[model samples]
Target chain A: MSEEQDIKKIMHVMRRAPHGSIYTYEGLEMILIMAAYEQDLSVAFIGDGIYALKKDQDTAGIGIKGFSKTFMALDGYDVEKLYVDRQSLEERGLTEDDLVVDVEVMDASEIGRLMNEQDVVIHH
Target chain B: MNIGILLKEGPYNHQAADTAFKFAEAAIAKGHKVDAIFLYNDGVINATRLGDPPQDDRNIAARWTELSLKHGVEVLACIAASKRRGINDEVMIEGGEITGLGTLTDIAIRNDRLLTFGD
Candidate 1:
């Protein structure tokens, strides 16, 4: 197969909040591993998943290891397609400035279009 | 079409596992190849042979083993997630193997479709 054909557009959809459950955390690990394969990988934050990108998160009191900082490192891993649903952020009273990393804030419809283009969509 | 299933929930507590299994069965019935079932997160618990649900309840692990043996579907559990949940080779049901994320990456790449079932 051609090099271009080998690139599968895989999107990891984050729909749960961080710390409450292991979905977001384990999903991050899956993204990190997939990033190394050099495929077209993207991560979308929707619903409470927007909280995963919120800045200054401290898990010290929650007794769970804080991994919010890991989002900032994803760029270095060459997995830069980070997207946030605009409605979800606003509904939660958060702005792009409140996020720890730079992301493309788009409407849910726009994100849905991108999702349609993906070869695989994994929701967490 | 060659379809791969990524199951992210354990049995009983959620319908994700059952739904994924049914989807696989339906896909196979439709003359499609169900390539494999990759278990992650709480989904890794589905591989335990030690689970002793009430006799009246569906035996989830046994169902996976049957799927693997009868239909040639590969049943895989993420090693990292399995280790964290106290699942190992000894506790794994027949045909269920502990694998890495790299295997999952391959499943995503090579399969014609990769469907994820979870909360």
Candidate 2:
């Protein structure tokens, strides 16, 4: 497990909506697993990915399993670095207060800069 | 430097395969080693040799094959994802291979960078 000892900055970019596709949910599963390795991890919510953390999501209506609350469990996994795109939120008419998890609201440029610094960037 | 590529979407239906090919090409052009290209989910279709596009269109599967054939890049599709999508070795492109997720983890561990391309 010497290879596991090497820490890398891994950022999982979520750009798709939940339920409509499995990207967001699967992306969360990835983050949770990577977190166990204790690498420097961050999750970015951009485009429709912003909806993944929206509050009061009732998937019961859609007859699909809802895991919106899973975002909250990320903190316990030590993967607390979550970033939300400011422009994406505005385009979707949502605010920081509307999400289920507390996140650092950042501009696209800021996220892009951080993305450049990562050893891995997993886009979903 | 060694680099790993993770492609998560299929060809034609999305621009992910094109972008990933372009990125891999550029990386190799810059003298960086593209250690591997791991296909997951719908991305597994990119490795299928059965893809036959119109004469006027660019062939995504062929493009990946060219990358591997020319640059020695290992184009791999996840066995789990490939099986679910009916992508077995028989249908794999000349330079493509069906591999397990553990290989992806090894690629991540050994590479200097692991970049992802998707829709």
Candidate 3:
């Protein structure tokens, strides 16, 4: 480790629901790319993007796969680091209890720090 | 480091700018500097001087203006996005400068990291 290896931390900030659009899904795909093809990939859910973390999303009514299920396999991609903003959760009335996965519940300040530490960040 | 904060949607309709600001403020807090915030696609709406939000919503428009005044975060509204959406800055009056792509590239290279946040 004489020379610094490019850790290349990528943070995918998703704040939308599971369907009606491809933004959130596309973001997850990008993170998959980072985790599968690259190195040091992380994700942060912000604003409505945090909604993607709901414990059990019933997307079938909306004609989409319950996205909460895919989140179940995050460990397979080695995308272990997930963060949710405290303010975003409070404003939206969401708490870790409501979420399906364990995420680093941080404030805006912590999320910003995560972004600064990374080599590349993509927000979808 | 090169920090690219992609704004993917309008202020009121999405949280693109709010998330970007949070990231920027946090980056600065940890002693890291944000070189530039690239406004692309719908993200370019943050640059409109004629910013207006509904009475019931928060003022994200004002937040962008404050980033410059308070944090000195260089706001580089994408020339392509700006032109498509109609955003023009002082230095971008002539030629392709109005798009602000050059500023984005400059900031990317100058900063320590480049980040994008699409709403």
Cα lDDT computed for each candidate against the true fold: 0.95, 0.87, 0.67
Docking class of 2: acceptable
User: Model 3 over residues B38-111: C-alpha lDDT tens digits?
Assistant: 66656667767675567887666566666666777666665655665667774231111243444543443345
Error of 1 at B54 (Å): 2.4
Against the true structure, whose lDDT is highest? 1
| Fnat measured on candidate 2 | 0.29
TM-score of 2: 0.77
Q: Write the per-residue lDDT of candidate 3 for residues A1-124, one digit (tens) a residue.
A: 1233544455667767667665787556445544654456688888788888887677667676666667767888888899889999999887899988888899899899988887666666
Chain A TM-score of model 2 versus the true structure? 0.95
TM-score of each: 0.97, 0.77, 0.52
Candidate 3: segments with Cα more than 4 A from true spot: A1-4, B1-119
Correct interface contacts retained, every candidate = 0.95, 0.29, 0.24
How far is B5's C-alpha from truth in model 1 (Å)?
Answer: 0.2
- Tell me which of candidates 1 and 3 scores higher on lDDT: 1
lDDT minimum window of 10 residues, candidate 1 chain B: B54-63
Query: Judged by lDDT against the true structure, how good is candidate 2?
Result: 0.87
* lDDT tens digits, residue span A1-124, model 2: 5575587787889898888987787677667766777678899999999999999999988899999899999999988899999999999999999999999999999999999898778887
